[model samples]
Target: MNLEWLKGIYVPILTPMKEDESVDFEKLRKQVNFIIDGGVHGILAHGSNSEFYMFEDDDYEEIFKVILEEVAGRVPVIMGIGAIRTSKCVKLAKLAERLGADAVAILQPMFLKPTDEELYYHFKTIADSVKELPTLLYNNPRIGYTLSSDLVERLARDVRNIVGIKDSSGDINQLLEFIRKTRDLKFKAFGGKDTLLYSSLNIGAVGGVCTTANIFPELVTSIYNTYVDGDLKESLELQFELNPVRMSMDKASFPVATKDMANINGMDVGKPIKPNHASPSGVVESMRKEMAKAGLLKG
Candidate 1:
């Protein structure tokens, strides 16, 4: 398969839960259709928003099965394999590959903070172990461990199967540097921050894995499409219109606000995983107002 098929806005879809905290498969199916209908290029199952780390192995398998059946080839599905150990990650990756996932997105091992060399070997081993399956590196400094540009370049050069990166560090300069340093390499680069989508596209980044797209997939897709269509002015303006909701949502826990926005838009994506504080009434009200102002929600 063409690795470039993974390009464009990929939503790290949230796992909506029932009141008893079980995965709401019916609601999730609606969510998948909603995102596909809204024009996202692909969907990422069990990323940060999907609470992949919080789930047990059996739960992940079940959720993946549901996602695969729901999507059913409507669009490509990139599975998230963010296990704490590389062995478990490889296991999940193999499962995803066997189940016909388009690609696997992995974050660096957290907590232990492996050295650059360790990190390199970790990814190289996973890529090698997975063989032909394309892998995308997920770099989010806000989460704790940061993948350095040098290591990223090294991986791109050494690991042919490692196909792309999702840079969510929120630093446009760092993203630009990643693009600059890795330009000759075959790996695709994507923006992870919603606010920097425009600049990321301008600087040769392929697309985005944006949380904001959960609520405004069309608008986010418009930003990318407009830019690619050479309407930089319109794309930038859409980004400006989207900035308020993006900023507000970032101020709170991620999938919390994201699911709320999805619910407001008539998709019944349920609550975030436990231990996350419930979104305040005022915050939801403000988000509603901002969504209206951004034209994402009708008055």
Candidate 2:
């Protein structure tokens, strides 16, 4: 396990689909290579941006295999196995471990509220199943319930392999509490929200896993690298510059806008898996403006 896993920007690599809505392995390879070449510390294959919910079990496994092979140890590939079912999550963890993923990130399954103990058992079972690989607890209450700071601390204490947590809540207090609780315990914290990237770092998070990076890798990664390089002024500058892009996205379907960025870059990663609407064409111009302002416009 890479103890220092949360060191820099990680892009949740998009699942490229051809016109038929099938997995585009060829485009996925290009997407992975493009982001790597553009400069990212890691790649997350089946995160929220990857539309993990839409993919079937066999297809999910196949996608992970493609990502792992494409990455080829160039950087750590953190596989997202955060399923709603405990037994299935355990099974998924085994698959991730077997397929050569560096780590697994699990989220609470579905939209039901569970007690702290239930959440504990849920994470514990998954960790125990893949005891050899490191586990990251994902705290994004919007999808499922948030992992309370106490629960996180308890998990860090008991789950020996639980090395980190990604907080997407956008709550500074919760993030600060997480950092405080886990610092001495040798646990790391990362940002799961792009909007909180700067502040999350200010409060001692190592880095982040963000969707915006899938669109503008250089610009998104600069926020972390510039801060780490000791130029706080430039780092904040980059963050503020991204505000319009984030604002524009707030009014639209998120992953849809994200795929728009990829398309603008000359790669058609397709739209978000259905039930949700595809991004409005208007959002693309707003994103383009932001990208151009940050000097990220494609040639």
Candidate 3:
């Protein structure tokens, strides 16, 4: 387990595309720098929020290359190597390693709902295939798959490269279970929800890999830092301040709300993928007003 690079808030960035659906390299670069400059500890390109499943192999390769080049070591680039097929995941993992990604975050195989043993084999197979790079298990149950805390412990014990787990289950009990069960191991656990950030840390989480960080990087990072620094009151206050923005996500498709918020704040991260419509203008305006009220946006 590579515990050294798994701490603090890691922003799962949204993929910016032009109106014609081409990859917007310029905006992509700007967005990367935006989050890094805003104080995020790491950038995760092509994760769920980044439309990882929508991209082809070539598209992923190109995006990974651009992200690695733009990030340029300012922060670790954690590339999403999640795929429906283990073989393909391994290929992407190897490509990420070659392209200079600091780590690879993989989601469990969706649709099939593999058994605990099968899930273990799936991750172990990929981890074995990519021995040189660290693997962060992404347990996002909302997306159709869930990795149990017991399975996480088993993986941590068995797979040498299985370094961390991101619990997006939104269940504090599950998050705490992972923390408690894996305490003796070298594995790292992170809260996957923006709302659960404070509690997750209170239970011994290393940090967070949150979609909300796409818009409120400083506030999110502050929550993690303040909590780690022992200022629980300030951290909780900041967490509460960002709740509306995080809750706004439940009102629309993911990256859509997140990307719109980014553009409203002046980052212009292009548009969401097809079928995932950008939020309505009214929703955008309301979010803008909320952001201003929260002091996240300048007048």
| Model 1 stretches with alpha carbons more than 4 Å out | none
Ranking by TM-score: 1, 3, 2
Worst 10 residues of 1 by lDDT: 248-257
TM-score to native of every candidate shown: 0.96, 0.95, 0.96
> Model 3, 121-234: lDDT tens per residue?
889998888887888898988668678888999998888888888889999998888888889988899898888898889889999998878877888999999998999999
- lDDT by residue for model 1 over 1-299, one digit each (tens)? 37758778999988888988888888888788888898999998988877887788888988888888999998889898787688888898899999888889888887777899998988888888888999999997856878889999989888888888999898888888888888997889999999989989988999999887877889999999999899999999999988888887755675678877777766667677788755887888888888888778853
Q: Look at candidate 2 and give me any clashing residue pairs.
A: 82-107, 84-109
Candidate 3 worst ten-residue window by lDDT = 246-255
Error of 3 at 296 (Å): 1.5
- What is the alpha-carbon RMSD of candidate 3 to the true structure? 1.4
lDDT digits (tens) for residues 190-213 of candidate 2: 988898888899999999998888
The parts of candidate 2 lying over 4 Å away from their true place are none
